[model samples]
Target: MNRIQQKKDYLKQSLSLLRDKFSNIPADKSVIHKVASPLRLEHAKGIVADAILKIMNDHNLQMLALLVNSCRSEVVKILNEYSEKYFKELKWAVIDEFGSVILKLNTNIATHNYLLPPLLDDLEESSESSDFYAKSTNYFSAINQNLLKIVIYHWRLFKNATEQGYLSASELILKSNVSQASVSNFIRYSLEKNYLLKHKIHNLYKFNNNCLEDLLEDWSFYYKNNYGKAIRFISYDTTYSIDTLLLKVKVLRDHNIRIAIGGFLALELQKLNYVSDIPDIRIYTDNIKYTKDELDLIEYQSQDDVTGRKIIELVSPKAEASIFSHIMNKDIPICDIIQCYLDVRHKASRGMEQADFIKKSVLL
Candidate 1:
């Protein structure tokens, strides 16, 4: 967080970005003009020495001096090549963290500008630039997931205890296992936000008319924002009708495999009639690995040819099912509308539109 630490993170990120950018290039290729190109660093690629000099000149002089002065023998040797004045760009330079240059630069360069390029991101979510949820807009924010967790926990508890017992704030703290300070803050915030209502008889707490829905949305968005990559996309050889999907799911269900359709499939289940290139069938399964036999069984049962099937790792399969309704009387179960919305909200395709429509018509 300090000036020096910030700069170190910046340098590391920039170096990492360059490494990722040219990851496709052959490591042992002649693109590198190393004083002695080590096998490990043969893959290194980035702006040429001239550009580095340009970067050095454009940036702080003190940091560059320290970079040069603190160089390890290898870095010194690398810099030795750049000792001579060069004007034009060098095609492929070895911009690797080969030596202790990073540590040396940090120790020697006392001060540096923290300005740097954006960091890399996960594949699917990073590609999505939707304003659908406004999670990043900071409109409705939580310091941590604790608030949502506590609220959902208490809501479920209240429902279970409605007949025999009356729940109070003290009991909530005891049940939540959260700190007293945090508990008090959450209670106050929920009350102020009209999410919680106090029972007149025993001062028990319950959700306001729409509090439960909002709480679930917050929870889903939290997972979607933090763990979108888990929603793995798959292709199916053939388009599946409701009857075929039902059969496929029933086969898995009979085997006790936990499965739920999400993404475009869920939209179809919800009767949205949304169509796609191959009908992105995203299924959340608890099973880490599936057998070829099981898939073959599904194929035999469904009789619907498919191109591909994408798999998304579920954070909490049981929890998701508990919050959403299970498809009725189907050979297999499908995720309720809420889970479907969460699954596709972060997708890069027409995912936002699907999620939004579901949220408005089904979830809300």
Candidate 2:
């Protein structure tokens, strides 16, 4: 049978097993909750374990099945351990039952496409402070605690950065209440992974904009022009490594003209007092160090703010000429005439109309 039929059959079998277990319990609401709660807790633990198992199986790591199998038993033992050692007032059995039901519902949805009927009812009862016994269960409590920590950390960092000028690595450590070593490791890892870039000025770090732009350009190009035919220009920034930039260029080599620029540097240059020519692009190493300039020619506007005047001048137009001269200097060889025409047309429509005329006259 097909994949759909196979999935449906598997789901049917699982649901049948679940139904049998479900029917054994009493039908009264209070009695049902009391009995099914433990089952729900166990089942939730099982679902997480199963998901882990499926991932492990896919990765050929099924040797860890022992650890996976111990999940439910370990959870139960831990609950019991806590109850016996710490608090006599804690009702872990109820927590376990509620968890099992939630887990069963989650797993059913995941594996069998079955929806839970009691979720809304449970949520309603749990919403009220008077229903603290119903709401403050271990499973939900753990999830809430972990989720809150993550959300709060992210929110606070985001707020601090936007409200304040910049957040340093040390600042992040203090704000996060994490160790300096841990923060250092995180920063190092992020830098290595190209997730963040460190500005050399004051050791300030920021999210990598070049990576984000490249991702956007890639998605846009793929969706807009699937065919490997024409030149499309993509704007990338300084955060990209030479390798990453090259890979993106190669993907679009057949049909794209990628424009590399120091996006952050460009924005920052506007604030600088120096009238020095800004390089068109800046290349960075995996270690986040500026290695060498990729492009030869650099250009910039004059310090004098002239309206609608040609205040900007190319610093190394000859260098630029040498670069493009290698590509376009020669007459289009006879064999490449047709391809050249198409290339010129594509580039022309993309605002290189002047190049189209030059190519047609020189090549034809």
Candidate 3:
């Protein structure tokens, strides 16, 4: 598709999402038509701005509630400047994109009416052609995955060092196996964010212990942002227990499968015994097709699918090599402590409990 067509389609999808979110409120089709019109393609920014203004005017309360919860600082500033009454309502809307609750309205309103945050997120993801639209919905766009890798590398070094070690860009590039450009960017960002304390006399960087919590929080979002939706299969093997399945998978190591175990199974492998019932087994691999083909011999999609079966999640991450940056236990490969924490923290099935146990007992 042409770029213009793609942009129009994106605008239409964004409008459709807004309609789905606020089903009770009738959509202003006139404003939507103006926003989605191919003839007005050159004036995309103006069209979007006009559409937002119209939406705000039409559904003032809903727009106000969403803006207050938005991560875009500029949007919040504009809302505060124009609508002072919503200032009091701001305190109740202190929720992030990943949070379960966004806004707490005292009045009776449909819960779905104030879902503009996700719509804004959609725009931020799809509207890269226009800087105006992108900046208007900018939400945690600063979190860099390369920075996450560098942070992990620094942490690994920090734990073993007798004294706090200072990081050099060249040394970082060599140790982390990241590109030279990425290392330079990470150092600059770290210095600005105080993730690293810079030496006054020499150009050296040391990891700031205080920023560990914040970095981990960013890593959680990075993990979710990248590998949230994974390709999974329900392995209905009534023949083998979860432990037995682990053995079956481990034997495939000889086939040159780049697999690292994660989720509840990783914790179990460490003999942490934090969880009694494992919901699913998560695996990170560079080669999905190969992994699936080999594992299919033991358990594959069959006509006899049923409930109470084990789930196997096959996640292909952008950082394929980093997934294997783990410590082995009893010949079982597992994702490192930090990766495992992020993998299970956001899960709904008592995952936070397990993650908390890891954080307090291991990470802390």
C-alpha displacement of 154 in model 1, angstroms?
13
What TM-score does each of the candidates earn?
Answer: 0.40, 0.17, 0.59
How high is the CA lDDT of each candidate model? Answer: 0.43, 0.30, 0.54
Q: Which stretches of candidate 2 lie over 4 Å from their true place?
A: 1-165, 209-364
CA deviation > 4 Å runs, candidate 1: 1-194, 200-204, 209-217, 231-245, 273-279, 291-293, 297-330
Q: Report the error of model 2 at residue 61, Å.
A: 33
Top-scoring candidate (TM-score): 3
- Encode model 1's per-residue lDDT on 1-364: one tens digit a residue: 4423333444444444444543522232212222222222221112235345654465322122211101123333344355334522222222222111222132223312221232222223323322221232332233324344444444544554653334467776665455676556565555644556667777766755354444444445455544434433232334435465557667877787766666676667557734453235666666634622344323322313334433323333434333223442354566655556666766677777776776666444
Candidate 3: regions farther than 4 A off: 1-150, 156-164, 297-308, 327-330
Angstrom error of the Cα, residue 98, model 1: value is 39
RMSD (Cα, Å) for all candidates, in order, is 18.0, 23.7, 10.0
Comparing 2 and 3 by TM-score, which wins?
A: 3
Candidate 2 lDDT tens digits, 1-364: 4423332333333334445645432222211111121224465444334434443445432111111111234444443454345432222211211122112222123212112211112333324422433332221122222222232234334644642444586777655555676556556544543435677878866654333322222222222232232111123233444345445433333333322222112222223212233222222111111112232112333433332222111111111211221231122101122112222233222313422343334321
Evaluated at residue 156, the lDDT of candidate 3 is 59
Task: Estimate the lDDT of model 3.
Answer: 0.54
Clashing pairs in model 2, backbone N/Cα/C closer than 3 A: 37-97, 38-97, 40-99, 40-100, 40-101, 41-99, 41-100, 44-103, 230-255, 232-256
Best candidate, lDDT-wise? 3
Task: Report the lDDT of model 1 for residue 173.
Answer: 65
